[model samples]
Target: MSGDHSTYAPRSGFTKWIDTRLPLPRLMHDSFVSYPVPRNLNYAYTFGGILSIMLGLQMLTGIVLAMHYVASTDQAFTSVEFIMRDVNYGWLLRYLHANGASFFFLAVYLHIARGLYYGSYKAPRELLWILGVVILFLMMGTAFMGYVLPWGQMSFWGATVITGFFSAFPAVGDWIQRLLIGGFAVGQPTLNRFYSLHYLLPFMIAGVVILHIWALHVTGQTNPTGVDIRKKTDTIPFTPYATIKDALGMSVFFLVFAYFVFYMPNYLGHADNYIEANSLKTPAEIVPEWYFLPFYAMLRAITFNLGPINSKLGGVLTMFASILVLFVVPWLDTSKVRSAVYRPVYKVCFWLFIVDCLLLGWCGSQPPQGAIVLTAQLGTLYYFGFFLIIMPLLGLVEKPRRLPNSITEAVLSRRQTSAGRPAGATAAPEDRG
Candidate 1:
């Protein structure tokens, strides 16, 4: 959506008047239809569009769920049950909203991974990347608060446990905890506060999403080659080419999302949540949703103090830092080469980092004792190390493969190789550089 040149032409008198006064239709045509994108972009780019759709779906379903939801602790659980049992297609709506959050996070994670692989955070797109990370933080907060709306066993204690992390601060910790739960404990106030915020934060996320899109359009999109768009030949209009690919990708993604919604609605949720909240009886073990597992593992990983800081504070800092670090990734990485495909060592470490995150997620789900604790600790180390150490050091030392002269060259070379032809078999065009 970066190209500002508009080719929109209103055909009718009323349309021409509207175009002159408002230009709304012209804006759409220019932004979505006529905008230019890299020809080399792949399916990974579709996650952005998918995320937009999921956000709207969540807002729509959440509004309906909220209309019938009771914020009171006594009725919150029952209200959810009522929706599922008596309301018109409430079960479908509930399942869709629940499953939609999981799918939303899934798409975002893949989107972030693609960015890391192709170095979308580098250079002119740094603000675009930062805005994305901000959206992610908003999503996490929104999801966590929304998770607590049901007032189920997990919802109640999950709120209690997660909010309690704020109390790890040395001086203001207790105050922050009180502020979050609206009191010393997770009770009526906590539910009301979380409910109100859960309702409002999605719209806030939407605002940031608008800014995110603006930033994306401003910087344009990055491709797999990490090369800047240099000529018209290296790009295509957004209407038919990128739109078709995005549609196919979204179709496949929605198919999987539908399967989860229809058949295994509760597959991703915990059984303990089906039971109503009982403060008197705590579950044997507390585990958050899958998306939070890796960070949860990191939070529990710190079992020892670092001099003045105790283990509890240390863990809290580490967990928050894990997310905050992402904001500064633009500077943390020292690589001149944008894409991991060009850097052998970075490519290997990138995959290993993914494995480490999965391992941490597994560790987070298990009881943190014996080997799980140790594994979580190691995973935590690597999680930070990948960003703090490897990213900075490897970029300086690693030798990357030679990049093609331009995006067009890379695309043509790949096509030729795949067709049993040698690289550079295609006719060479004038290099923009």
Candidate 2:
């Protein structure tokens, strides 16, 4: 699916001259306009484009908020208040930026789940998947730092608690923690550094997004049928089909984002974050944002220590391993089939994994005690076990149903069935060929 290298014919003298110097327009035309997309692709494919729009929205709103935000520990909380009351439309900008982070993560999770279902990470698309994981890591870092910029009770204590994770390291633990916060605790230095990094990392994510799209163009897209394009009829030009679909997806996504920003701006945020920072007072229960909850639950689930390793270090390792496990997922599933649509057993396990994640998230939001702790422990076990044992074993044991011969065939069959004809009915000579 590597791009066709055919030169673009300039339509005018201006474009001809520009093309001679730099062919950026031609590159765009080839990459997005004339690119071939599988005709059988479903709505799940739109999340990638929606994620791109969300990234742009986040950067725009973040820049505006940064203009009014103060990073100093002394003025940070008061400055946020000032922006809400004094700066023009500042509340709107702040809400958009805050809620945008949640929406961004929501879209990314959907995108990842879609990829897993369709096997988008297999074979030629491995680099594309790796780039996406890198983007996710960068987004997590950027969001963590941005949360600290508000200097609210949750922001300050959250920073301290998260940075303290580095202390789980052996001899260098203290030094690592100090390096992260710039002192023994979260203070002016920590705020300034987080602000700087929060501002810088989005552009880095944008740079990686370019590589991800390039990789996508090289491998093309995996369709619902999980079959490679074998003929011209199997695909449609990206311009009219995919571009229009992406535009519609973006519109729907913004409607949901606007609902959160306008109706319940603080719905996704913790109540504790509304209060100014007080080092002497810790919140009754410390919790990260909803997006980080599953991993947070994993971190707190470990209560016992192995020889020379305490529970704190074990929990930290367990949390990090949950994400790192995804890096090797392409190699773990040994099935020749791509889409889970034909793999009955894998589909059931996939939904179970999703439920386990949701359960872990709920456990993370609660205090680590009683039945919740036990539930989280079990959820965390399934989380790791699904990736490590279930995926590999299922691939070898599950028998996938026969796949459609091609994307065109799949689409034709669906159309025929919708028209009340049997899927196996005779097709036109051209379609059959």
Candidate 3:
């Protein structure tokens, strides 16, 4: 599970002494500095850096915006408006933070898709992938809490509907709901706690992300071939090499983000958010934000009530279990080959998973009746089947392509035969820095 290179921990006193001036410039001399990387990393790998940038942007804008806004459920919506109208730069900050969320999800989905496509979640970096999942779940919870702060109709009702789902458990579900809400309903207290957590959880995610990278450094990144790059020639120092590549990737990603911010800031947003919350008159349809739709749809798919258990509790467990199923993926997929490219059966099934996700997203936005319900149920079934049946089956049936003798051989082969580039094509020019 460990990478070939030992980590660069701080050395002893004399080493630390000379380190400050001469520095462990050797640190940069390692993988990233002049490190050669996969010349064909593709767009998916760009996401980790893109997500990091977006998290920073959201944090900065959010802190400034928070200064103008009140957290009280009563004053929350109005204070937001005050910031929009009265506070300088409030509109800019709000839009950036909100749109940053949409972009964050966009990048994360692509990142995850890339992992699926390239088999980035295989044995060597499985923990990094799991850490990414942890970050993703926290992002969701953070986004949910932030969404409620606007105190708009969708925000208020979304909280009510989502929190109310907890009561679907058997005997103790109702009590859990009460504990979550501090009462039978989602109201002022729920708003306060959610807001507090919303503000706090990003830091927690950052801490985990640090661990994620620590894990990444330990195992190194898995490429499309899932080959371990062990030879010294296979890696470049992480500084200039990874730094430049990451920068280029980030720049390309920001262009997409900029277009969203400048041309259509509200394109991804629901129009209902403009309306103030009305506790008495509910909106006919109460869909959550697009990012939450797939799982939201999953929660609504269970219609048959369990004996003495509410359908809502059924939905709640189904919701959590949907993600819980993912935690078992490493074990669930028993394929010897890591990359789906070499595993034809797994490749097709992985695409099926993508299709199911898209279908679930569509179902989430529509009424939970008739065709929508049927579609959700089917999609939900396939979602589980991909993990439970398809992945495990493919491991037994699929014959993998011959693997390269080493990671360097694999990278070299692709460079020469496929890309028409030299073996060390990704290496920097002399003045690259």
What is the C-alpha RMSD, rounded to one decimal, of candidate 1? 4.5
Ten residues in a row with the worst lDDT in model 2? 1-10
lDDT of candidate model 3 versus the reference:
0.80
Per-residue accuracy of model 3 over 178-266 as CA lDDT, tens digit each: 88767777788888888889999999999998888777766767677776676776655555556777789899878888888878988
Clashing pairs in 1: none
Task: Report the lDDT tens digits of candidate 2 across residue range 1-433.
Answer: 3336343578999998998898888888888888888988888999999998889989998888888888998899999999999999989888988999999999999999999888888887888999999999999999999998888999988998999999998999999999989998889989999999999999999999999999898888999888888998999989899999989888888898899999999999999998999999998988999999999999999998988889999999998899998888888878889999988998898899999999999999999999988999999999988889988898898999999998888889888778855443566667656
What is candidate 3's TM-score against the reference? Answer: 0.88
lDDT of the candidates, in the order given:
0.93, 0.90, 0.80
Ranking by TM-score: 1, 2, 3
TM-score to true structure, per model: 0.96, 0.96, 0.88
Misplaced by over 4 Å in model 2 are 1-7, 421-433
Off by more than 4 A, model 1:
1-4, 421-433
lDDT digits (tens) for residues 252-298 of candidate 1: 99999999999999999988999999999999999999999999999
- Clash pairs detected, candidate 2: none
Per-candidate RMSD, Å = 4.5, 4.1, 6.3
